[model samples]
Target: MQITQLPSDQRPREKLLQQGPQALSDAELLAIFFRTGIAGMNAIELAETTLSTHQSLQQLFNASLGDFCQVKGLGEAKYVQLQAVLELSKRFLQESCQRNTVFNSPEHVRHYLSLELKSRQQEVFMVLFLDNQNRLIHQDILFYGTINSASVYPREVVKAVLRHNAAAVIFAHNHPSGVAEPSEADKIITRKLISALALIDVPVLDHLIVADVSVISFAERGLI
Candidate 1:
């Protein structure tokens, strides 16, 4: 059935306005973003088909331009819009992290890092340089590696911290395998970085391991 033929409250836009965006299913949300559908399918149906093909919103968002446009009702225009939306979300989260003390809101830190790193096809080591107040001063992706490992140099990390004049630091890296567990190598490296930064009187506050679905904290697990 056509979306217009559905009850007013049942339509994606009306449902969003009446109840809130969270009240809508993924398909409903995508339908609103899509605006229109192909000749035979309605917007909701098209969204459902797209989601089914991709398996999940994460997979869809992570798809390359070519891969995304291969969907029947989707094209380059939709792909560009989708990338813009994702970039906006990342920037919004970064702004939030900058405005507040990240240690005070660990979830925000996790969320920001997740968005930054989770979808990456390779391992990326990121450093979040924080002031004494724990507010974010700067962030940079210091190293990029293959699917499983990144070569992180403590000297380079220290140089970055010094360059930013950071008082403290939070280390985060992503595993493309979607397992949040910190490997023995991860532990060894965290210890090395902590020791390296300690000499400069810059404490390593926490180390986070980001996977596709979750973020794990070394400090929380007594690993740091």
Candidate 2:
């Protein structure tokens, strides 16, 4: 059926105008970009086909321009349009990561770092610098390797905290092995970091170890 022939409240574009973008289904939202239909299909039908070809919307977003163009009735122009929207979504996610990250407690820190570190295949040591109000000032990757006492330098931690003028800092690293439990080496490094930061009057707030879907907090466990 023609989209315009549908009830005004049920039409994707009309519903978007009346209720906002969130009111539209994934296929309905996609159909707005599709705009037109070829023989034997309506715009919504074509969109449904496209969505079905790639099992999920995420898979569709991850698909290359060539992949979209290969779809029947979808040409390079529509592929570019879809690619541009996906790129904008990616950029917005990155910007949101920079802006909206708040580390209030151990759980907050874990949630923030999980989004950034959960997918990493190798160990990545990162530091979160916070201001006097505990708002995040900046986050930096300090080291990327096997987590061990020999690899992390306490002096570098001190220097980075000073450079950022951070009142407090949270340390986090990922275990590629998917074990959130801190090893003896991780404990030793946490002690070293706490001691080094203490000398400069910059407090170590927490040390988190991120595994696949879980996190370990040093402060919560009395390890810090």
- Return the top candidate by TM-score: 1
TM-score of 1: 0.97
Instruction: Name the regions of candidate 1 deviating beyond 4 angstroms.
Output: none
lDDT of 1 by residue, 52-100 (tens): 9999999999999989988897999999999999999999989999998
Worst 10 residues of 2 by lDDT: 97-106
lDDT by residue for model 2 over 84-165, one digit each (tens)?
7755754555454445544444445555577667656668899989887676788899987853322789999898999999
Per-candidate count of clashing residue pairs (backbone under 3 Å): 0, 0
Cα displacement (angstroms), candidate 2, residue 217, comes to 1.4
Which pairs of residues have clashing backbones in candidate 2? none
Judge candidate 1 against the unseen true structure and give its global Cα lDDT, from 0 to 1: 0.94
- Which whole-number lDDT from 0 to 100 does residue 20 have in model 1? 99
